[model samples]
Target: MSSIFESIEHAQAQLKELAPNQWNAFQQFNELVFKEGALSVKEKEIIAVAVTHITQCSRSTDFHTKAAKKAGASLKELVEAAFVATAIKAGGGVTHGTHVHNAKKTDASDFLYARSNLQNLKSIGKNAHEGFKGYTQFNAAATTEGMLNTKLKEIIAVAVGIATQCPYCIDVHTKKAENLGATNEELAEAIMVSSVVAAGSSFTHIAKMIQSYND
Candidate 1:
């Protein structure tokens, strides 16, 4: 397998080139965030680690497992993240299981009585047209050209999935990105960016809680 990192020195080197003022600002931000936010960077890293586990992103699980440790996250935090992810996945499994259980009592012809419904679903193999008749349109104003492409968009989706702890989105985006030929390295970087963004969002929650507490 590829190294968890190409090398640690490389990651530190990239960190060095950031604008000093910006880096300082964000570091100060994350410091307060670590203490007062709904989640610490440690917690965010823990969640990201669990997401990688369930999504089966081998490189990501490996990298974030170490990152969680380096961030001072505890085993409890990691376990919590896993529980949340599993809950979401198990909920989905229950829904699918119900359909399978009903299959025994329901005839296929009756279950899908409408020919059109069956055709549309069965045609998924040959046609995505009906399957994606109104797929979510990207915001033209928010995302620019390079970001809107398939590979890059999948990268962004994976980032969002990790940061948001959304298992289904994680599964979709990981598969899509791989199908589009995204390298393991690029996906890892995208996820790192997402982790920082998620950490920042925790600060928003902290502010809200502080405001409420003060009031």
Candidate 2:
């Protein structure tokens, strides 16, 4: 079997012949999205790293990990960006426990109503509540004033929460980001970055599918 790295290379090679216009469009979009704007290139790359992890795209993770380094993000910064993804993703799961407590069936409405019941965990389930507290502490340490400041980290967290479809996480981090002095514009741009990266990830993988069909 070909390795993932080999497969990525194969996909790139095949795209030029199979879908040149798509390949060019993807390249242009990648360049434009990461260009400096309201957010710095480094910040965008950090968001890319976090979103790639949320999407579980190894190829994207590898690409953005390198891109982030080139943009002057330290190894510590990269890892912290990844931890933002970890915390928000885990928070998504942890927050869902509220639904079980309310005996509420899962749906969009559950996410809206179940979130308010999270505090009930403290009274109803001490151990799980304690674990959640520890997780919160970990999240605080991971995102607060590190190589990346709390504001940027929170923005990345918000974007990850959105990409992961975690409403609770999104609400929590959006407020946190606002508290950290992130403007609405910054928050919106970060979300757009996530949207572009998510779409790009799918576009890149079409080449993989093409290769599979040809094989």
User: Tens-digit lDDT track for model 1 on 1-215?
Assistant: 45423443244344445345655677675444334233345645654665564555554566677877888866655555554445444333322333333355545445432323323333332454532332222122212233134455455556656655655556756887788887786676656656554554443334344445544
lDDT of 2 by residue, 57-138 (tens): 7778888899889999899888989998898888888777666656644443534455577675564347566776787797
TM-score of 2: 0.85
Top-scoring candidate (lDDT): 2
TM-scores of all predicted structures: 0.37, 0.85
TM-score of 1: 0.37
| Pairs of residues at least 3 apart in sequence or in different chains that clash in candidate 1 | none
Candidate 2 Cα deviation (angstroms), residue 182: 0.5
Please report, as a residue range, the 10-residue window in candidate 2 with the lowest summed lDDT: 104-113
Indicate which candidate wins on TM-score: 2
Report lDDT per candidate.
0.50, 0.82
- Alpha-carbon runs more than 4 Å astray in model 1: 1-132, 136-147
Over 4 Å off in model 2, which ranges? 1-6, 104-127
The clash count of every prediction, one per candidate, is: 0, 0
